[model samples]
Target: MHIPRWAIPAAVVAASGMLLTGCGKVPPGQQANVGVGAPQAVPDPARQDPSAAPSQSAAPTVLRVAEAARLGKVVTDAEGRTLYRFDKDTARPPASTCLDSCANTWPPVTAPKGRIQVDGVDRNLIGKTKRPDGLWQVTLGGWPLYRYAEDDGPGDVKGQGVGGSWFAAAPDGKKAGGEQQEQDDGDGNGGGRNRWAGWTVVKVRQHPRLGMIVTDGEGRVMYRFDGDRPRVSNCDGQCAKTWPIVKFTNWKKLKTEGVERSRIGFIERKDGSCQLTINGRPMYYFAGDRRPGDANGQGARNAWWVVSPRGEKITG
Candidate 1:
């Protein structure tokens, strides 16, 4: 029998773990870009970095509703720049904690006249709060709004997970982006009673070096093997032992955003196991990875690597 290029011979499987040990180590500078669940660095607006502060433009008096490809419905300024909410801010009391440098980097959405106009949003939820700078900032559903300086134009979400504290604001004053809990359906399929249901099977994970990559429901990084074609499982026996297949119980219930549904399907392994495929390539998890967001398997032996939402391999 001819083994696929991705499949390792049984002899190599016995020592694969030892040979692949410590292969996941990313360089110091490269690791700095990986952002897991939240952002670690608090953005300092006072640093005076031109890129860190919004341009000097007229304050937007009207807020509008815009659709983000991955974030659904989000609130934007008159110019269409995405507005964000700080995780540290309290909604009940309606306060603005972003001051000085923080304010420079994320300029508060000021409503100078205390009266603001809104489009496609509930007018009742629109309100105003006093900032430390003595400016009246706009508030939606009791949450203050701000624009990210890093965003060059409208619809930029560069601050979405910055410092793990900032996120795009929803029309209802909720965080526009982040992971949600997956509910288990009685069937083996992972679906909850909520609207998320099948859509929760796949999600986005931010890596310091890899930007945004696709992850399974448990947040484990998903990988694609180069040797296999679409709907084919070339990794078997010892090969499968090192890189286990990623399988889903119900294909119809598998929901995904930012990914093409036509590229998703399954393949039968030699051992009679069903493995998941994206864009005709089989997906798997590294046996060496023990926790969520682990991409230790990336660049392994110049063959394994994590995949982007668009089904491209993240080699770097």
Candidate 2:
């Protein structure tokens, strides 16, 4: 699961000629509750046009499976959203469609067989599924996986649903945390949430502390608890030290694409300044996690797990 820092460029170049498959992802959780950023450039919608049909061929007859632990472990981007990539095709869904030309654009994150290990997560939960062209692909709860070509780095998720409804599979096949879900809807349109297979829906709460996002290994979108909603740091500031929420200066700085703008509200604290709290819980970072590929804060204090608006928790 660890991609060496120096070799990325070479691997990307070599990936063009090779066939690197992907694995479905998952996020780990303990008990319940939590919440979960960003606008870069609008990549060409054409490169992702699914109507074009995949120029790539189907996968080979056999594929590979990975340990569930590796898939469950995660790394979030600076925006606080988890980063997922296509395990196979850059655009195709369920099966990997990236053949020769497309493979170069996106490379699957793979380690030597048996080289990666994740603690606490069940190994049996991780395995592979067969793609139509015979390629043995990594699957999370049976769903196929892939990575995005548009993603230039390990954490960049620009390729998610690039070609339309097909999205990058999370380690659990769903997403982690509620607020984190915003990152998944690249255009900020709330509709992409429909793709989740196991995620629950929020009822009535304007912004639940826990928001739903994708968690591939579990086969649906899910939510994980970030912390008790607050501004003074009820997490003992231990949580605050880890999962810091992004502060936007103006409403214009904050763009809720698909989510209703009204659903997007700000909270002002006694401190006079403001901290963003959805459903009351303040967001933060663990610093325990370093890279976008590192997910050190899955379930802290043991009581935390990602949940959806309806309060459904995602656990592995």
Candidate 3:
């Protein structure tokens, strides 16, 4: 898939353990980049660089962050796997480099063309895109849907904050470009200066099913996956037969209790119709996500991970 310069900063607390969508959101202004010091890249585990601390340099003019804890939610697959969020993201770029043979390592969430519910999230701004293969891809507010190839096994977060251009999607599930969260007053360990380094702007999103899933007593989405990261996506044309798009014709018609207005949104496609993009990525009914809460796609790739609304992993 192609990466779009304008991506979603959707921080997710995935209820499932799988990291497919587990692979995670948005482009914030360049000023508040995650690291104040130079960002070093290390591919192999042996070469993993130690995480750098934020410098006490001048703060960025605008610091985009996840919504406060109160407004956040969480998601989990049926089997009780945990999820987390990626702290980084880039501008709107729709092309995803993980495809073809690489896609075997990470499967894309697939769904057919349709209309999306636009009850709360700015539905008017939702849009869609068409790939070179003529396949219609959904866009939230404009951010395209994609899967991460590096995410192996369910709940693996290898894709978290890659290139500082990507991030783990939030529970809200919609790719929204709303205002950034305000900085906390208590920043410094001592007296006056704000501990800008410790404060992180969790990129988040709002998907259609985030807060709408059938939950357990403790409110966990159940996820079950039989593979690991770097594994091949077993579902293909025919394999995808069982898992379909959980589509709805009109947002005005459905009646969901306790669901937030901002949590719901729409995505438009090339067919002139619209679909749903959770938090900002496209939503797909996993062919194997059977039994209403099953997350069969977790761990297919190492980059996949889930998140909570408050920016934590979704656990029982």
Best by TM-score: 1
Error of 3 at 58 (Å): 47
Q: Give lDDT tens digits, candidate 3, residues 242-300.
A: 43322323333322212222233333332223333233332334445444244454433
lDDT of each: 0.66, 0.34, 0.29
Candidate 3 ranges with C-alpha deviation above 4 Å: 1-97, 117-121, 148-158, 162-164, 170-316
Give the least accurate 10-residue stretch of model 2, judged by summed lDDT. 23-32
The predicted structure with the larger lDDT, 2 or 3, is 2
Task: Name the candidate, 2 or 3, with the larger TM-score value.
Answer: 2
Q: List residue ranges in candidate 1 displaced over 4 A.
A: 1-200
Could you list the CA RMSD of all candidates, in the order they appear?
A: 16.0, 20.5, 23.8
| Cand. 3 Cα-lDDT | 0.29
Ranked by lDDT from best down, the candidates are 1, 2, 3
208-235 in candidate 2: lDDT tens per residue?
2333432222122222353344322344
**lDDT digits (tens) for residues 55-127 of candidate 1:** 3245788899999869889999889999998754545446676766677788999876546888998999888
| Clash count list over all predictions | 9, 72, 109
| Residue 137 displacement (Å), model 3 | 1.7
